[model samples]
Target chain A: MTTADARESTPSSKAPRTERGRKTLRKLLDAAAIEFGEKGFHEASITGITRRAGTALGSFYTYFDSKDEIFRALVDDLSGKVREAARDALQSELPALETERAALAGFLSFAREHKEIYRIIDECEFVDPQSFRHHYETTARRIHERLEEGMNRGELREGLGEAHAWAIMGMNVFLGLRYAVWSEEAAPEEVAELANSILRDGIAPRSSNKG
Target chain B: MTTADARESTPSSKAPRTERGRKTLRKLLDAAAIEFGEKGFHEASITGITRRAGTALGSFYTYFDSKDEIFRALVDDLSGKVREAARDALQSELPALETERAALAGFLSFAREHKEIYRIIDECEFVDPQSFRHHYETTARRIHERLEEGMNRGELREGLGEAHAWAIMGMNVFLGLRYAVWSEEAAPEEVAELANSILRDGIAPRSSNKG
Candidate 1:
């Protein structure tokens, strides 16, 4: 198969036509995460992914054509999982600040469970620059949308725009890197509260209202 | 020379005892930054760095025994430069919030001027993980100290700690990535002001003081 055959492997494309096919595909991606995370992109091999997945070599070819294809696919898969994890935490009619807190808490938990996610996505920078940029840009856009919703509801300050969203995204990402991936000294709830408070009351002294 | 010889090359160690030696070392490091930033760690070669520095190959081996050693040194150099940029932006006795703004603005300007910095520092994660961790840990410690100073002076809130410092650092870094490195559509002062306002009043609406 040509390298272009890998394009059909993504869920958005051909995907797996049968339920069994879908299950096999899921196993393949999960195995790919471990393989790439442990060995990094250069050292990771397609055979390693299939072996970890407990699938035949033909099954691997039925989906991805090469290591690069599966790595890109895995990045997109993790990106979606990050969004889903956050979405699962939110309830309708929650306060703007509370929404952010829940999302971050959920994300931190997800990050801890899948610490390998960080290594894979970071490695994507060298393996697939386009996917790396797309993941962050898309994530930041989601954040910006939430900020706008809060503004329209009269919950947040006016003029909370793209830069504010990017700032908050940065805060969440770095907090995860330090607290979740690096170590577990701090609880996810505690770390989320710290970030949430920044959005709610900021770091200014309470009694001193200079304005 | 043995691999151990590279250990003496750090500025804290041998550090090129003479003025001419120091200048040559600086040129070598600056060239390494560009080479690593452009070609990345794996593709980047020691010869590539020396050629870019316009120095002889002997000079390369004089300071670093291998490409990995020079890459580690380069990460340290960039990390120090980040600290200096923020320090140069500050005037003694500035307000706590203003200090953060000045530091961020300085960082944004630095990122803009040395757009290669992000790639080089990021690649350090794969090439030299210890230096990568050290760079961030050191930066967060510096920011944490500043926050404590603010609290002591009654210029900021109480209970602001390492997590908060990490949050602010994340904001500055992502803002720099989006605005300074990726695009220059927004001014550094403008981005700094936006982040400053978040620290000052947060995104909560003005009329809603339910707490």
Candidate 2:
């Protein structure tokens, strides 16, 4: 993620004014992800995060006030990164179903590289409940928007709504957990295609009545 | 759940011997769910569970040696209950897709009643990582087995396997999180049918080419 992304993660008052400050803020948040991801919320410390970032304690204080502050910020930062990863994956114009496939593939790839993301985001449920809710709500909203676009284009089924979006999000999240974080037996693209197939045609036998 | 289920949750040596003992054990576990669910693992205390159970501290010890032991048993007990809920929902023979719908509806109903369950299970990732992994892995395995059965019966598509099961599980789980735990905007059957529709026909437009 870039320093620009880092700026959005921090509270405006504490956000970096200089480019160097933004870099340090980004470093601290990235370090916080590793620290919290490895040691968990309670065991993770400001000193540990600073040490990992190779930044001074003063630098950490400039961006974040405490470990809780940094942990919350890290979750927000990671959420933004997740969105960026999917956005980057779909730079090309693709069919509606292919867009979902690309999005899942991007997520799985990101999860494989940053496995700690699961731990950090999961822990946010306890550490900062609001951020935890915000992450999923925002994600589901994005998926819902995509579904609406696909429907409007006469590509996806009509009457799709928030529930379908949540279902798709859940499928992507769990697939990443199983294949990307828990094990690497399946490649990201392979896992994504498998999921996309469900959205494309589902599991019902071809000859079965739609009813 | 029956006393037999409670018996399996605890260590064999610690298993309740008499009817009264089993009842007390179930009480303790039920109370522990509320304690952990409301206060979380770190903050939940043995006394809190015992108090919620309306049993003496000695009775709590009779079934569990420590808070950690009781918490672990609670996760196991809840996992079993989840299976029972799905199984109970399918008392009569159902088409493969209908079976999936019933299971999702049952889970949604169970989740709505035991809202604390998500917190407990999610917290297991931190308090007891093994049980957390065991919960999802076991659930996925059950789903995979069902998919295999459906394929053999010529119901679901032939290539359906573990990935499909995981996808369905993810869909049900996130739908539950959105509609059950977070808000009760939708009925359990209503939510379940929406997911079942996805599995039955997918999100592709009715006239869209399958490719």
Candidate 3:
């Protein structure tokens, strides 16, 4: 199954049985994102989340066991959404370099719309260390897989590996933090193209031009 | 003055008068690193930091007025040390790419020795947002300066600028997080070389080898 389908089926014990139940679960996760994002984990309360969702307190326990559980679930939910955003941008076949550029552009747009994502994810380091690590690890792994595919297609260098993926992931993430979350001084397309140029030719002077 | 000298002169009101006082101040900052690193800003207490330093309450007051003050001071101290570490690695003049490699290697070694640096710096985002942003902005500015120097020296391609610096900083920081702080699976030199290769040639296959 695709990542979105997997996300839909995850946190299995609390999986919704009815369409109405799924809507409530979605509402809780969305509300948790805002509550936790604005107030952070320590200051964020389940009551606040429920109030934001306009759902009853009973509806909360019906979906999540506690605040921590929902927070963890929210992180997982967001991670999947990040994947989906990138996936949506890669719906058509494109050259490997263009693929990377599209993915970053998509991420920048998503981050701009969901500015709270940075705070929520960063707080996970203290609030939920395992989830924090998992998010980046999984994201890097996905990037590595894409790099491997690019290599197999003879579009990238032969030796690209986990380190290269980590490098690209870091570049995209920091760019989002600067351009998307911090300020939109430059357009996302411009940012993505600049990063893509680095991936294409690096900062080294071309030998042909040196002479 | 150099960054190190500036670091020494900072938070100056409570500056040490003698060698003994300097030792006491160092003790407090080091202890604060451990306290804030392990327990985080909220759970970390002034007494906890003082006890860890093996200093009395009077010494804590001598340097910092409260936990918040010490945390802010600690962030500044650590940011300065990060610069010093990179500066130390770059004591000798080398090519621009080599400079980048040495800086990454230095950072990885520093992170391994002081794993708490990551937690402490990350926490500053919430506890002291200004310091956190300042730390990254200054670091990026330094990198931008290096890139400009590289371009002027004819060692790097032209058009490299602030975005490129942020990209390189992100790459080094994430690589240190994965390889140094999380695990020492890869040697610092090896990781630095891998990143340097990307800076030099990127992940694109060389045209000569395309056949």
Please provide, for model 1 over A17-103, each residue's C-alpha lDDT reduced to its tens digit, 9 standing for 90 to 100.
Answer: 799998999999999999999999999999999999999999998888788989988988888889888988885668788889999
DockQ score, prediction 1? 0.63
Interface RMSD of each: 2.1, 2.5, 2.6
Estimate, for each residue in B47-69, the C-alpha lDDT of model 2 and write its tens digit.
Answer: 99888989999998887788888
Q: What ranking emerges by lDDT with the best candidate at the front?
A: 2, 1, 3
Among incorrect, acceptable, medium and high, the docking class of model 2 is medium
Query: What TM-scores result for chain A when each predicted structure is judged separately against the true chain A?
Result: 0.93, 0.95, 0.94
Write candidate 3's Cα lDDT for B145-191 as tens digits. 99999999999998998888888999998998999999999999999
Candidate 3 total steric clashes: 0
Worst 10 residues of 1 chain A by lDDT: A1-10
Write down the lDDT of every candidate, Cα atoms only: 0.87, 0.89, 0.87
Comparing 1 and 2 by TM-score, which wins? 2
Over 4 Å off, model 3: A1-10, A208-211, B1-10, B208-211
Fnat scores for every prediction: 0.75, 0.84, 0.72
Arranged by TM-score, best first? 2, 3, 1
Per-residue lDDT of model 2, residues A26-97, tens digit only:
888888888998999999999999999999999988887888888878888899989989999999988899
The order by descending DockQ is: 2, 1, 3
